[model samples]
Target: MKNTYFFLLVIIVQFTNAQDYYFPERNESWQPISPVEASIDSNKLDAVIAFAKANEYSGSRDLRIAILEGFKSEPFHEIQGPTKKRGGPAGMILKNGKLVTQWGDTKRVDMTFSVTKSFLSTVAGLAVDQGLIANVDDKVQSYVWDDTFAGRHNSQITWSQLLQQNSAWQGTLFGGQDWADRPPREGGIDDWKYAKPATPGTVMEYNDVRVNVLAYSLLQVWRQPLPQVLKEHVMDRIGASTTWRWYGYKDAWVDVDGLQMKSVTGGGHSGAGMFINTEDMARFGMLFLKNGKWNDQQLISSEWIDAAITPSQPNVNYGFMWWLNQKGPRHWNGVGEDVFYAAGFGGNFIVVDRKNDLVVVTRWLEPSKIGVFMKNLIDAF
Candidate 1:
């Protein structure tokens, strides 16, 4: 009897999944507000709808909304549900072209992962903007504590190569992630061994190892963690705040041995530029779109903003950590050649369209097949 009941439940889910519709979270009496926007490319939309309808058993959508409840609502959180429970596809639109804002949760903080890379690029730009560093073309060994060469594979690398992510610093003999787990220098943290060399601009391998290298080198030059730099230039300009919240039950995280334990400009470390909410993320997009203008004051220069979006790689459409879609759509040039995005693993995205002034944020479950969920939601926009 129990098996029969479970099969019936599965059949019910399959039945609902066959419908070409999305279910946003609401009370039993809650009703959906239909989307308001121009239709996406018709044929493309139809294809997505067909695919979603056909994949009823693949994944279930977790959609929720509470209009006007403000940022204090519990919705702007890391979804701890199953792999199908979506996070922030949690989107917004601004009259001034701001996006993923207005649903509130603007200042609430959360992990942005590689989206943190975009913030790191912002710091790199500021470093160049100020006289802190000369240019992105300088030698990274010259900036940070180097010594990667005293070994094989890498000996002399340049800052431009690091920014371009061509630093062939073989991370781990096993794999990149294994190498990242244990950095080579000081036995301290993963920012070690950037002192090695690379082919400069000749190769293109997408690397997260380079992201930490930029962080460490910036610390050497900026004389502070990237978080402090971001607090002043990036976060403060957009009115984002920071706090050291309690963990489990003990003392709040503070400096260990008088230096900050570790920091991530874009991944893992919650404090190292991780704890920002969607509204702040939207303002960040706006900052880039308006050429680094927050209201009346000019923060980062327009030239800097333009340079940040311009592609910086021969192999990938990336500029300092920001992804660009220069291939102009309708091509298989890797992940939407027309829709430039800031991608974070575990399904977090900030899709920016400057031509249309649109930014879409989708925080979803990976491991689960929520890609269809994302494509459907994006189709409606």
Candidate 2:
């Protein structure tokens, strides 16, 4: 009976500790604590950093070369937007919302590839939260009222479908064709180009063109550049650094309310997305880790965070642009299934492990080693 009571008290204390998260102020250095203070094994944490540095992503530091060579198989693929030479392996680990440790140049800004999808996902959530979007399930055509969402298949797509990357939205936007983005390596261009698309919500395809469609649609709904909306509502509220910049392909500009607006891409596949530092990525991850709340402010509603993390029907490993660790192809062995993250090309990741009260951001780590790396890091705690 005494042991049971003691266990209950320990659990209560841990819960309280988890709730007392530290949020950093803008332009202030993030408060850091030793691994021992954070209940992490110091030597094991060192090993994790060594492992990450040794297993750097085997891509060109000159990302323009990486992007072009990486997608050489795609038909007519070319760099359409800005690309930056990435820095070495950089990362930050947060325990109970305070920085536990970091390695490499955490301040250097670099392209974060498809992790921008998660930010795009957040922008959609903001729209839903502000009532600009009536419902996630409502067909997108009803909002935009434009030919972009016209046609039988595309008109059937909903905001929810777009968020899930399952909308199977067809056609060309900003010179990018849906089927030409990342077609199967074995097939000829014509085969993929002419293939019938799966119904919206029935298939989750990782196509940048479809992702840009979401960005363009959101642009119409917000009537402003997404970067501005993100800055005003999310980034500024979270106290993120001003150095971060969202970019779109040079050809992705459109007229909105008599003004031209650039529609950002959902990723850096064509070399446009979020160019940000590791610290800002950590801050963004922490926001999601705290269920969209930063200090006293609820920047993004808890309800939207819940919906964002919930797995979509088409992909158990995916949830509204966030990657889930649920039992599926992407599941990391030995890690809690509840863990979710924003994964990008070139091995950038912002992992949110709510169960462990942890947020980890890694850049330029070898992609395949993430599971082992995360498993080891969690074990240290």
Candidate 3:
């Protein structure tokens, strides 16, 4: 009987210790807490960082040239955007809302590829929150009467479909071909350009052009620059630094409300996307970790975050540009199924584990070894 009572006491203490985690104030540095203070094994946590450093990406090739090589066969328009000098493997891990561990230069800015999709999806959610978008199921053409969304197939595409990347949106945007953005290597140009169109919401394709189309549609909805909207609505609210910038292709600029606005790309596929630091990325993840509530204000609605992480019908492991650890296509080894993350090319990731109150942001780690690093980190808890 005494042993049972002692065990119950231990459980209660553990549960209570995890509550009332810290929140960083705007324009203030994040408070750091030792791993042991957070109830995490310090040595085991060290092992996670060592594993990441050992498995760091070793490629020395120029990122821009590599991007061009990947799309060499496609008829993609050549466009140049800003890219910063990238550093080696760097990251930050936050546990219970406190900075627990970090390595490398967390402030060095680098290009975040597809992770921009998650930000773009957040902008769409903001539109929904403002009532500018009545429903995600409504046809996008109803909001923007442009030719990019016209015709039988494209007209049926919905906002939700675009958010899920299954819209199969057919059109050219910013001088890039929809079919040629990231076509299958098994097929030729003719096969890609003239392929039969699949019904929107039935197929999942990761074409940057389709994502750019979504961006263009979003620009029309906001009637302003996306960067400005993001700053006023999300970034400034979260206390992110002013160094970050979002870019579109050279030819992506268009007149909006008598002012020229650049329609940003969803990723750095053909160059021009989000350039951010790991610290800012960690803060973004922490916001989602707290269900979009930062400090005392709710930046994004809890309902939208819930729906954003819910698996789409076409892809069970994919949400609103976020990758979910569902049972289907993608699965993290020991993490809960509710774990979701924002991943970019070249191994940048913002992993959020709600079950454990953990948020991890990594840059330039080996892509294949992410699972290993995450599994090791979770095991430490």
Candidate 4:
């Protein structure tokens, strides 16, 4: 009789604890809950922050130099967009939709590099939700009839392939070559340029030039600036701050709907992507955490979110530009398979663990240390 009573009491307590969590309101001041209250080890959280600060990117202070050094063999496209002086290690950890802990200047707007791809992917998802994009598997050529989607091989590519980084679309955009951007170390220029094409959906290659092409193609589909599309459909709806901005290369402008519009890049690889603060990023992650719903409203469809995180056939760890923790070679240790994240070049990440009702946003940490950091963080619970 005593054991039955105790079990009932435990169940009641767990239910009450789960009910206590709520979504944050859209405002500059986000409410925070104590780590103890959220059932997270305060000591472990502090250690994670300390480890991030101690081991940051020491490669180069000058981002342009860093970019050049990272892509040594590629022909340089002089950076035509803006870059800010990056802040120190910063992060925010949210438990059950409330900010549990944060470190450094979380408001500092910094270059998010490839994290922009996730945002770009969300914009694409929006199109799908609106019925603008009929289907993911539908050939991109059906929507975009330009030479960008032309040619025998390119026409075979689908929207799903582009989202999965498996399009294998060969072309030059914004003065950058597909082969030159992150070419394989084993191959020379000729090998990269003349490499035989793989079937569109059979290979996964992370190329920013191809990503930019997707961005450009998306612009044609929407017939408006993507930033505006995002603001109306996602950001403004989520109550994101006005400080965040998405940018494209200087040469990426095109006349759209009788107006000159600049097509944004999917990342800051060649110096233009989303410049957003950690707080805004947290909100974005929260939206995904809730499966594209904010509060009582559904901003992006739940179906779209499901497809966005579903593992691509070619790369089990990648899905619609978002990284997935799946049964694959690149799985995140100690994390749930349902966990998905937006990762950038400089270790910027927005990790969303839906099973645990958690979201972690980290900036400027060493990329290699992420697995250990996540392992430690999960163990703390």
TM-score top scorer: 2
Candidate 2 — what's its lDDT?
Answer: 0.92
Task: Identify the runs in model 1 with alpha carbons over 4 angstroms from their true place.
Answer: 1-89, 98-108, 145-155, 170-198, 241-261, 269-273, 328-339, 365-381
| Residue-by-residue lDDT tens digits, candidate 3, 193-219 | 899988999988888888888899999
**Candidate maximizing lDDT:** 2
**Where does the lowest 10-residue lDDT sum fall in candidate 4?**
17-26
Task: Estimate every model's Cα lDDT from 0 to 1.
Answer: 0.50, 0.92, 0.86, 0.87
**lDDT of residue 314 for candidate 1:** 66
User: Residue-wise lDDT of candidate 2 within 2-114, one digit each (tens)?
Assistant: 99999999999988865679898898888887898888899999998898999999989999999998898888898999999989999999987788999999989999999
- The TM-scores, one per candidate, come to 0.60, 0.95, 0.93, 0.93
Residue 310 of model 4, lDDT score: 92
Clashes of each: 8, 0, 0, 0
Q: Residue 371 deviation, candidate 3, in Å?
A: 1.0
What are the per-residue Cα lDDT tens digits for candidate 4 across 265-369? Answer: 998887889999999999999999988888778999999999999999999999999999897988977878888999997789999998888989999888888
User: Could you give me the TM-score of model 1 versus the true structure?
Assistant: 0.60
RMSD for all candidates, in order, please.
17.0, 3.2, 4.0, 3.5
